[model samples]
Target: MATTTGTAAPELTGLPLLGSLLDLKNDSLGTFLRARRDHGDVVRISAGPPGLRATVYGVFSAEGAQQVLAGESANFRKDNAFYQEVRESFGNGLLTSQDEDYRRQRRLVQPLFTRRRVDGYAAAIATEVTTLAEEWRQADAGTVDVLQDMARLALRAVARILFGTDVDAAVEIVEKNFPDVGAYVLRRGYSPVNVPRDWPTPGNRRAAAVHRALYEVCDRIIAERRSSGAAPGDGQDLLSLLVEAESAEDGSFDATELREQVLVFLLAGHETTATSLGFALHLLALHPEERKRAHEEVDRVLAGRTPGAGDLDALPYVTRVLKEAMRLFPAAPVIGRRAVAATVVGGVAIPAGADVIVAPWVTHRHPDYWEDAERFDPDRFTPEAEAARPRYAWFPFGGGPRACIGQHFSMLESVIALAMLLQRYDLEAVDTVVPVASAITLQAAGPARCRLTPRNP
Candidate 1:
């Protein structure tokens, strides 16, 4: 069902000065839910003072999602204010670029994530996960912070996949400051007022410093790659692939292009996988029955051998578990786009300049599409059950042309990582209740601690 096409849209009312901005910022999921319940799917949330313009329409229906993300995607370009603000840090990276430049960049980088190329990365991913598991065993600790440990593993895995053997130095720089760098950028991007970096405010100063640190990491990586003068397409790593790639016009990606793309991949790729895996492990830990099933499936399929690219399809249960985890806690919870031209969605007439928000967190849990939506049930992702629902109902990686390029890599890496970990150890959540916090990516609000009991061979 397409959104009712009309001019009237219910506006979410608020106090005189603030509107719903503060609530939206503080508790985005809660705020969106309240608006959807009270108002219709197309609810207007207004913010800012009398003169300044700050208004965003929350589109919570699958129809609206298709309209903005797929059907009428061209009318909703990535030149939105949010992406503009994000571009300050991301530069003209694929995540931030629009139109021709975005398309060309996508073309050049698309081959790197192809099935063949990503399959080549399986051994390195397995190696990283295996090494992390061994270190945990050696520690012999009672409890480990799953979120913290997963973060480190994700960073190291991505570092090796992107840089191969020359990852030690770059990984250190990224690991140390990645959190602060992400927090600073997100904080400023969501702030109502745009504070200039040169203003020297505490937040501004912090963002500037973190920005420099992140750029330094990217710069150093690019510089090292360039100095090596390795033949394009000489190696299997992503950097090598990018160096070897030629544009439609037969031009190579320059230094700035390389840096921006690498930065986006580093930021978007690892965090999403790490957060989703943490949630999956946390959920599995809480459900012994499900964990047992997973273990049984792994044992039947791999027979205690390390998981590899070929084993991914054979481990259906592991894939289902990951899908369910993402359904409940999508890493990119909200997808926003600015209407470049006048459009009507779900019966509401949207003006040319309106900011439209499509939230997976909301739509994925909608009662119409999902049964027992809040429950952690991997069975919901079984082929039969998934085929029964709308295609857009469970899109954790988004849809259409601009959907996540590395989704396949993320999924494969996750399956391998989880299978290897579960094969060697049984994990239980230490924290009875883990809280969720949304930064650039959705993550555990506090430490999600887990106790690992090593399995005897």
Candidate 2:
């Protein structure tokens, strides 16, 4: 155990009473970056007023991130206000579950996400990307919103993979309600004070309605699956595998647990990948040299054929492009955890019960670990380069026991989608400077419009 040097971490100065609340709300990413820039890697940020004030111990260095997320992860738990808000809105799925529940969920879901299993879904990903490529090729308007389009594609692909024959129903419900649900989670997650959810407040009411609808849809899907009599571990889709999963000691997820897991998969499965894909395309469009290199790589490896899991390794440059994009715009920019005990990270003492945040948004750009960090450079991810950096420096999918189970799945989907898209189109950025905000995920605050010209046209 590392001993604290009795030194207190520097605090970010903020306005009277509200502290950094307005700044955080208006520009969280900027505020975090500024915190790291003005102060050192470990800085204290306070928000809200006196009694209701929420103070976060912001860990901005790769070393600190490693300690909080992997080294001393037990000391840093997911019981923070942000996670509570997520659990209330999204249910205690693996993403929000803790301790024994998380352990059990991980054991059950881990087998379903093995490399071989995730690779099998590449066909589904290719199918969806190909479909979108065709739609883009045939569209009357040459320009499209990359973020919105990729979101649709990711949702459709994941839904199909998860639900198999029943994808249409799941996709429709998620597409319709997720935006609002995400908004609600973000609003309440950051707010210093929130009214009782039962108070019939507009936000509360809207959240409840969306939650009910989402739950009902998931429950209906599970019921249909059960009615079909699909045996455990026998069905092709993920939902079937989950439905059938069981343990002699732990048993399997009940209907409610199934619904929660499904909702979590739907939310996490699409959004993060969409953010990566959209940004990769946008970045490639802005940098023609990078785009051309990507196109060449895609053209060579794919040879005008659809990409699959095998091509993932074959197209290293394309993968790097996605990696670089993730570094610049990681989907989960700030990951929050509550400290269970007093701890020292990066030589700064963090007291027990502190709201600790390990921000990839800042760590990925940490000057000590990255040179020209803000620039989009895929070569930074070359095997040699990556091995040289601290493991947590570029952690877009997070770290520790709670790292994303869908890491492989997300990579496969992004690589396949990018390779296929690059193989089919010549991209140009119509909205060159895309404004972004940190919500539940990194979001495009403005339109990320790109002009797609068909390659063979």
Candidate 3:
């Protein structure tokens, strides 16, 4: 059913069954690598559609991804089946919304991620990471799952920067309904039809309940902040900004809309940061020279003091290593887009309603684009070397009009956090590490256990 960019449909082999099994096995990246090796840049597979089938292709090529994300952006929409799967968990959130709604919502929220705003958030990020690191220092040292710790860290930063100082309690609120929200997607077996919460299975029931909890907590924060009459754009935290950030055209978000915005921040923000941070640490630990360089950069730039906003941009080597780490193991490893209208991209005809997956994991490692593509080499991103490479070859945060809105904030936050940890601690995988891929993000299967010894006196 699937056809190449050229008019000729690929000769049907056993791929329909083979591809289906590989995908159902949930090793999507592995499947992509196989196809890229078997076919060229463009590979077509039967996805059970009648006329049009999904295309598994590369986006790591700087020119190729740019064309899809920027040049021909109008042809794409975020409303793909993959995103639709999580519709209940994130209804109209920025990551999945389409067209006019997406634009309006994005415009309303853009101010939160501006350089000035994110720069101000430096102290908050530094303080949070320091507190967490201090607590870790006080604990018995052996192995720690940096994933959970990083998740908590990113969430707390969100609390201070987005929800104000009150984000700690909301974690439980999200946990309550997060289960059923997944049944809408992650159920061992699930039905799409909406059954009443009470009548729904336990997972669905929990999903509905947790969803309410999320809304209520958001509602409370919005109500409290609005009632306080805080100064407009004070940048106290995210909740206040949502209450105050007025678009030049629409004025400001309604209370109902603000709730959706909070949910958007919660869903879009945390996991990606956490996953990247963990993988960065994993890479540094596995590649000790890079870890030492990152540490030395932090030490040279900030001395022994905690890193602040000013220190981030100056920590060039640290950022490069982190960039390489992300390039090797991008947090949002795979991103999919569907064509809402027929379009031509990479000189290939993309028909309307076909799924387009541009995987950073596969593309970032494409042999043609990178030297020693599989090895960990942070120096490859050095300024001179970067200039030599094509532009879209390494997009950890993606690019173009619909690119990640929080790109700056996330980078600032990530750099600061990594500096804090590297200054004092060394971490690694205790045993062989196996990465597990899921509907949204990539996670290491076991505890990233490692001996965390204090730097020599």
Candidates 1 and 2 compared by lDDT, better number: 2
Instruction: Between candidates 2 and 3, name the one with more favorable lDDT.
Output: 2
Q: Which candidate is the best by lDDT?
A: 2
TM-score order, best first, reads 2, 1, 3
Q: lDDT score of model 1?
A: 0.84
TM-score-superior candidate, 1 or 2: 2
Q: Each prediction's TM-score against the native?
A: 0.95, 0.98, 0.89
Query: Which residue pairs show backbone clashes in model 3?
Result: 62-392, 162-238, 177-210, 180-207, 181-207
lDDT of 2 by residue, 1-457 (tens): 7675657989999999899989998998999999999999999999988899889999999888989889998888988877898898889999999989999999999889999999999888888888898889766589888889999999999999999978788888898999898888888888777888899887788888998999999998899898997556678899999988888868999998999999999999999999999999999999999999999998887789988888889999999999999999999999999998887887789998899999999999999989988898999989999999988888999998889999999999999998888888998999989988888888888988898888976
Model with the higher TM-score, candidate 1 or 3: 1
Model 1, 1-457: lDDT tens per residue?
3343587789898778878767776787878878887887888889777777488889988878877889888887776666776788777988889888888898888878889889889999999998998888865475778778888888889989888886787778788777876776777767667767689898778777877887877787777777887765677788878877886574778988888888888888788898788888989998999999999998889898988899989999999999998999899888888887777877787887888888888898888788778889999988999898888888899888889999999998999999998898898888868777566678677887889898854
Which of the predicted structures, 2 or 3, would earn the higher TM-score when compared with the native? 2
Candidate 2: stretches off by over 4 Å: none
TM-score of model 1 (CA atoms): 0.95
Query: What lDDT does each candidate get?
Result: 0.84, 0.90, 0.71
lDDT, residue 212, model 2: 91
Model 1 clash pairs? 3-346, 3-347, 4-346, 4-347, 5-347, 6-347, 6-349
Clash pairs (backbone) in predicted model 2? 232-244
